[model samples]
Target: MRWRDTDKSSNIEDRRDQQMASAGVPSALLMRLLPFLLRTKIGRIVLLLGGAYLAFQYFTGGYSLEPSNTSGFSQSQSASNGQLQDENAQFVAAILGTTETVWNQLLKGRYVDPKLVLYRNMTSTGCGMGQAQSGPFYCPADSKVYIDLSFLEELKKLGAPGDFAFAYVIAHEVGHHVQNLLGTNAKVRQAQQATDKVGANQLSVGLELQADCYAGVWGHYVDKQLNLLEAGDVDEGIAAASAVGDDRLQKMAGRAVQPEAFTHGSSAQRIKWFKVGFASGDIASCNTFTAK
Candidate 1:
């Protein structure tokens, strides 16, 4: 948690001032088309299918309708938000720097450092359009991490407040980048395509749990070598892992806890995986797929 005085990464890209350019089918056109299509059974079915296709495209990084303009950078936002942005930016850079150091040593200098893109509202990414609602994510296609600083406030709203919680979020995204580097993501994608919906969801849960473990692995290095973690920092990270579990989020929204619908595993699974990596500090211990 004590990250302010640490080394800052140079791979940070600040796109906080960009503006999104509108493209693709407009929402108004869809609204108009929907009513007309709903007049007939066939038309209504076709419309539903088309909507589902669009949603799939949007989620899979294939249909970016908005591209951000790279015009300029400014600090014209709220003074308090501006201060938080500056601090969070520095804090994130420090975390990235630490990850670079740890992975370089762990991989024996073969680790490729990923760029972190800090944007506001929306932006164009290799994995389609980035939105604040999507939260923090790493784009394997771009080899970069995307985050909106406002998500820090949202994390606090989810009851996971503290610098270590924020660090865990960033580390989890970086974990995805690690998977990308190791070809684990490619393997998972291949496996997902060969499975049914339930099986695919289970595979996704394995991937997410592995990322939580990777975050804990980073925490292990940060605590063991960097000595930056305070007394309650591990608890903060565990709280964050619990907060974002698919089951926890579903229960929070007043929905049933359906195991087959979970993509990110349950709260207990997340905390368990994190603890696995934290206790062992070994990448081999993070094989969530083979765990019973």
Candidate 2:
């Protein structure tokens, strides 16, 4: 991918230096003790006292709930990490800027650029606490995308490597932002609410496939308009899409290929949809909801 020459996006929120912390008591520990606390009078008293103590501490600023730089690292190690993070941040910003350009042009003034946040380990989002284990995700509630760059390493481990592959991942998340902007996400949520588990999963599969298609649409423009793609770049994007396919992942986990359990469709489905959008470069042709 020819991204270094591209302009970096101004919408990036870098929170990689910070880590979320609990105040007074950890929420997980409190939840674990809740049932015991409610079962006995002494436990209830203890719980009440604990709650009062926490409240007093909070009011007096005895503990902080804000994200803090708590990493205990040597200066050399910190410097090294900082350098790598800076490079990765620049790459992310460039890709996001390309997406913003394409979407803004396509939407013709209706597109709102979504904020992309770079964090390490975990971060607080509009959708609640986002963990690195969950990979990258877009939170519609905040109109932002949260990503832990470690997932890029994870993608390499999943057999998809290269800059374009990473760009596809970012584009896919941005595709979800487009869905949110066009009200497609809300409509899908409403439809999901009206369906059973299997039906809901099917809707989820459709939604995910649509995002893949949208990513391909973005890829088409970037390659055609900006000349960002090089040899084998498209293959990397396809491999990245296939790497996370529901069926392929389930098979990797030694499970049966159950279409009913799929929330992101099969590898073939993903590749097909991506190709559909890439081939046509048309949003109308990318609709997976009504496709057979």
Candidate 3:
């Protein structure tokens, strides 16, 4: 990916692996937030099991993540801020700075940089208890991005590759940030609150698909302006889009593919949207609502 020497995103918040290992999360908030996730006994069991698994990982080595340059990080994979100093952190922030430049120029407005928070196990966010299990997410409340560096390895295992894949993930989250800025997320949330289960799921699919498109838009200029993409970079992104499709995840989970249960689009839809934004590099072209 040639990322070791390239400009890192200023928005990045790498905590480094060793320090993250020291930051074991507690369970009090999980108990408090249990009510939001379920109403049934079986659901509660699932939640408890997930929490226990996260706890085990926090203390052990599951959450360990290192930076792209792993010269000093050897204790674990978790990106720990305590063990890592400001230099590594700047590497991430530099990458984010590039994203801000690309997206701002693309969007033609002052780019509001989302603070990419680097934490171990769990951290306080404007949203509810932020944990590694939630994967990488954007909190609209505070306009911040969250991620666990261990998930970089997870992405590779899932078939998403290279630094571009990481950039795609960030851009996709930033896409959600774009939706928040454009009031698309609020509109979707409002419509969801007003609708039944299936209709709301449809809205979610649209929203997620649009984020894929937004990521592609970021990819377009990133290649044009920075010359960062090598051959097969775009293909890697397509592979990633396919990898995270609801259908693929469902099959991996050993569940029957239920279209209604899809929060993210199918493999075809995700790839199509990302490609749409990539080829066009126009925000207006990412109107999944109209296309649908």
Candidate 4:
């Protein structure tokens, strides 16, 4: 929570000023190439790395990939004020910087820094069109994390208010980047594609819970090495994990809480895994895939 004076990450891409008018539709060439690339084992790498580069360039105004005759978009400046001094943006950058430090030490020089993209309303990403409603996500294709500052307001609405809670969210997304580095995301995606809906949901829950544990692993480092956590910070983080549980969100929406429908695990499972990583400070202990 002591982030105001902390260093901010230079890897942050500020796209708040660039308003994406249409959902980023890929160029025809890219759409045709991706499927072909995804078919082979080695090609998956090219698919993620190369496809992402072309997609990012197309979406971020490198060139107009769409035809001029298409009715999809027009150029216009963002109406939202995209200021650097915005307190929330600074907080996000500082947390990202902290994650960079933790991950560098943890990965031991193998870590390539992932940029965090800050956008307002909607944006184009390597994955696809990013909307605020999707919350924060790590797009492994581009090696970036996409977030809308407005998501903090939504987090507060979910009863997870506190700077540490927000930090946990950033760390969780960064955790996904870690998974991407470890090839966990790719394995899960492969498994998901081959499984039934319920089985795929189970795989998703493991993936998400592992990310939660990774977040706790980062928390462990910050508390032990950096000495940044104050009293009750862990509680705030657990509250955040609880607030975003599949069961909790389903209940909030007044839907029947179905275990089969859960994608991010139950509240107890999330809290448990986070504690596991926090207690151990070891990534090896975060094997949610094999845990009961």
Ranked by lDDT, top first: 2, 1, 4, 3
Best by lDDT: 2
lDDT of 4 by residue, 1-292 (tens): 7777777787777676554322355443555676888899888997677657766776586744232443322222211223356888888888888999999999997788888888766677788778788999989899889999899889899999899998999999999999999899999999999999999999999999999999999999989988889998999999999999999999999999999999999999999988988899999999998889
Q: Pairing residues by index, what is the TM-score of model 1?
A: 0.81
Off by over 4 Å in 1: 22-85
Worst 10 residues of 2 by lDDT: 73-82
- Give the lDDT of residue 187 in candidate 2: 97
TM-score to native of every candidate shown: 0.81, 0.83, 0.75, 0.80
Measured on C-alpha atoms, candidate 1 has an lDDT of: 0.84
Quantify all predictions' global Cα lDDT against the true fold: 0.84, 0.85, 0.75, 0.83
Pick the winner on TM-score between candidates 2 and 4: 2
Tens-digit lDDT string for candidate 2 (1-292): 8888887787777677664444645555776788989999999999888778766775687733354455532211212223434678788888998999999999997999988888777666778668888999999999999899999899999999989889999999999999999999999999999999999999999999999999999999999999999999999999999999999899899999999999999989999998888887888887899999
Cα displacement (angstroms), candidate 1, residue 155, comes to 0.7
Which stretches of model 4 miss by more than 4 angstroms?
Answer: 22-83
Cα RMSD to native, each candidate?
5.9, 6.0, 7.9, 9.5
Error in Å for residue 90 of model 3: 6.3
TM-score of 3: 0.75
Candidate closer to the true structure by lDDT (higher is better), 2 or 4: 2
What lDDT is reached at residue 131 by model 3?
Answer: 83
Residue 272 error, candidate 1, Å: 0.6
The lDDT, on a scale of 0 to 1, for candidate 3 is 0.75
